[model samples]
Target: MTSMIQELTVSHNPFDMTPTMNYSNTTDSSFTNNSSTITNNQSYDGVDDFLLPWWQQTVFFLALIAILIIASGGNLIVIWIVLAHKRMRTVTNYFLVNLAIADFLISVLNMPFTFLFLLYQNWWFGTFFCKFSCFISPCTISVSVLTFMAIAIDRYMAILYPLRPRIPRRHVIAAIAVIWIISIALSLPNLIFFTTVEQSGVTLCTYTWSLDKDLAYNYLLLILNYIFPLLTLTITYSRVGIELWGSQAIGEETSVQHDRVKSKRKVVKMMIVVVIIFAVCWLPMHLYFLLSNHHPAVTKLDYIQQIYIVFFLMAMSNSMYNPIIYCWMNSRFREGFIRVFCWCPCRPCKKFRSKLRFRRTLFPTSVNAMSEKYSERNGSLMHTMTEYVDPDVNGPRRVSNNRNIVRKSDDYL
Candidate 1:
């Protein structure tokens, strides 16, 4: 057996299998065989050697399926709530709608392929998916980060300068368009640099770049997607926290002012939690890539492949988390999600209608009582009284004597 193995090696290499063997003058056949042998050996190095047991594979599969369901369902709920309900269409929520769209695309387009790639260690999909996935997966993530940044800035402006006029709806739309454009442009290089290459008997979808260029690109992504956004969120939220919670005096603490402050603080806290969760979920994946690229020897370790899979799943879970955060932290979003999913049956609808009816019935009585009181006091009827009902929330506001003046509700804020 030893002699046969030696003969096979000699036939493949045609030279002594020593470090000192010079290959410049070797025949093409021998060089090809040697290269093929090395490639075949490397193909089984990482995932194959540490392949999980059947039960573990089953658990992993179930986990990925759960992620798929949660990511898709949760993000779709966010999108629907924002789009279907006028109450949810604030400037900040519009950015969130953009975020939901990005996460939805990631959940639908990227997660399944990623699961297959990790499980099989090869790209079974054709070249089209190879390039398409490479371009879109990162693009969605970039959009998410950019959208988060936009939300942070929007919050910063609203909290820091409450007196200034809010950003216009058109400007918010333009910002969203710019975010998508920038995200696509950032991912364009993936279409050029990524392709499917055959290794051993399997086709692997990967980047085709020089080592230096690959490293540079990876670092660029780390900075743009992770580090810079994290810093921006940290600083902006820190300032927002101070503004909301710090020693700002409220000289006249009316119920309306108190509710406004509480609402602002709640929003700030929810956004801060979102930023922290994003950083936590994504940090491991970025660190894994950085370490693998900078220290190739780590890839040869026994459990390195498993660690990489865990890191990837952690990163992908980010797509599922924001909707959960929204549900848990914001009552309005929670109510919206409940309404979207019909989780509460007819209770919310009945309550909403009852409130509207109550307000409608009460407003006219109050107005009539006030008019009678005014007539008794002033000996004249007030002809300019106007009752304004907020169409979105179905709440009746106070009647005013100002003509042609429309009152906007602050419920969205």
Candidate 2:
């Protein structure tokens, strides 16, 4: 009788309604048949039928749990190593410390909820957690991404302009502060826009902004998360590769070819691998979100389901991969990991002894031997000159004359 019921009847599947309907005024057989037809055409919610099993949930959560263990433990170690080791306290390392902090926060905040959300298949967390969790997710991600970009830019500056003054400590601190400020600003939208809803008796937490708003948010998210960062990382790393490889090809005599140089070159290669992985792992998800801006019709059931699964898996996978990247590709991170896990035996005492040993061994007996040789040669030349002059200019050479000269010098003093 009404447009709402008419639209609902047209949109939903038939044969899902209850059998009893009190059409008390319908006496005509045609009206009774129309009432029966309308009753048969009603449909109830179908989300319960579509719910996935626990194991069928995002595989990314399992991966995220594993990474959480490692990242929590690994990042703590990095923080300790960077703080304890004076060598790691440079301006660049300060940025690294912030990056580690960001990673740690992500693991602490994002990974556990991810596992729980996947297990439940719907938001079991209350309204507070739903909004808080969603809000923190974007913040953590933004911090991580922006930190990586900052590190890339720092590396580029270090390589491209080595002679320039080191980035000031104050500036590094200021940059980190700015990053947090911007990250919070980006995440602010989630707190405002995300909501929990009860649709057909199933309560769910989702970003329920309309198509236009979601598109704008998605486009901004993609730009912040992927496009600009990917572009900067790609170009900077490309230039770094060219610069380092070009140096390797220069005249060997002019260069200090050593294992240390080779090790740094290897580090550059590893950084490139990290950048590539960052791009490859995250690009598709961003592209999907970006294309979602078009608000394509989801009339096909399969397409909607597939999109949901793909994005869910993509997000889960993204959260789990960062620590693996750090461990697999970064030697500094590996070393910090070892120290963090207390793998080095008696590290503090060993470090002290190592410094003492280095100080003792730095200069050897060869240096003293050269000094002795020079002294002997100078004394012999003086003796030969004295021998040549004494017989012609003086009366005779005598031991008593040398004793008399010493006595005269003592009396004068």
Candidate 3:
């Protein structure tokens, strides 16, 4: 039974938890019948013997610790900026908040366990966490990818139809909700399949599936989480780039229009870089899994374990990089980070408050200026319409009323 279980419980290479091994053909009936004893003996042989040297392990541990700190801290700042500031709550920023939430969860919940697993090469956190961490690893990644896709689509609509009404806040909320729902649904299979098994006395957490089922799941993850999102982002951003740079003026160019276009282009460029970075980071990990599963010989290479660690860490580092990118590309986010982090004296706060008051004071004057300009454009028509009216046509009172109405309109402006 133990031999059979070992043969049946091949690891699926999703999270890179399971070690690669070659099974030897055994015909001894005594070994087959008492396989449990052999397993126990192997377990007692010590799994820690495979661990890296002390200094190498320390370096790996420190790297993971740094990644955890940066990823969690950066993503928290992103969430805070979006939630605390009214100006930061635009549609794109809303999607960014969702992305940050996913990254935050991954940083806090997923990375530490993964670090331990990489260090120890065994499941030490027990069964519940074994299942949970496996499930959420894919879930958070799916959410991030879907959010990126949604942002790409949003940008496409905004650039392609500049005059169209903006997506309502409710709809944006609904879309975010849907992205999580889909992500959870996609991750349900992992929860069902992941289990802890003791082999050769060493406890391992891995997904146990029939060969066909494993292949199907891998292909599904590759398509849904990776390939499809990458293609959609690439196509959508390409169209957005063409639309942004292809046409000059559908009508007369104003300073406002030029500035708006420039701002949109800047934002689009930043998001494009974001999408590209995500793709580049995760692509190697996905390819590594694909190659390892299809051509098992690749896993036998001298540095395969080290290479796997590098690729896996690269993928995990995706969550850490986005906040840095945002601070680099967006001035508002930079200012928000500075305000949140910097300890400023009273003078700067006073200056900021005075600037706000000045803008408030100018608001009504700006509205009046717009109204007067609009009224001036139609002044000739208004005069023509009122010119032919006689004082006695209706009554002298009616002519007086018309003049009063005109006076009031001018006064309101």
Question: What are the lDDT figures for the candidates, one per model?
Answer: 0.62, 0.49, 0.63
Expressed as tens digits, the lDDT of each residue in 1-413 for candidate 1 is 22111100000110000001111222232332211111122323333543567887787788788888999999988887777766556787888889889888877787788667665655788777777777777788789889889988888877676556888989999999999999888888776777776654556666566646655665677788778988888888888787767745534343434455566676677777887888888777666555544454444455554555566677778889999998887655676666666555655453444221213223344545334321211123333343343323222244554333334343233
Worst 10 residues of 1 by lDDT: 10-19
lDDT of 2 by residue, 147-188 (tens): 778777776776566445657778988999999999989888
Provide backbone clash counts, one per model. Answer: 0, 0, 2
Best-to-worst lDDT order: 3, 1, 2
Q: What is the lDDT of residue 125 in candidate 3?
A: 77
Write down the TM-score of every candidate: 0.76, 0.65, 0.77
**Candidate 2 clashing pairs, residues 3+ apart or interchain:** none
Better of 1 and 3 by TM-score: 3
lDDT of candidate model 3 versus the reference:
0.63
In angstroms, the error of model 1 at 361 is 10
1 against 2, candidate with superior lDDT = 1
User: Number of the top candidate by lDDT?
Assistant: 3
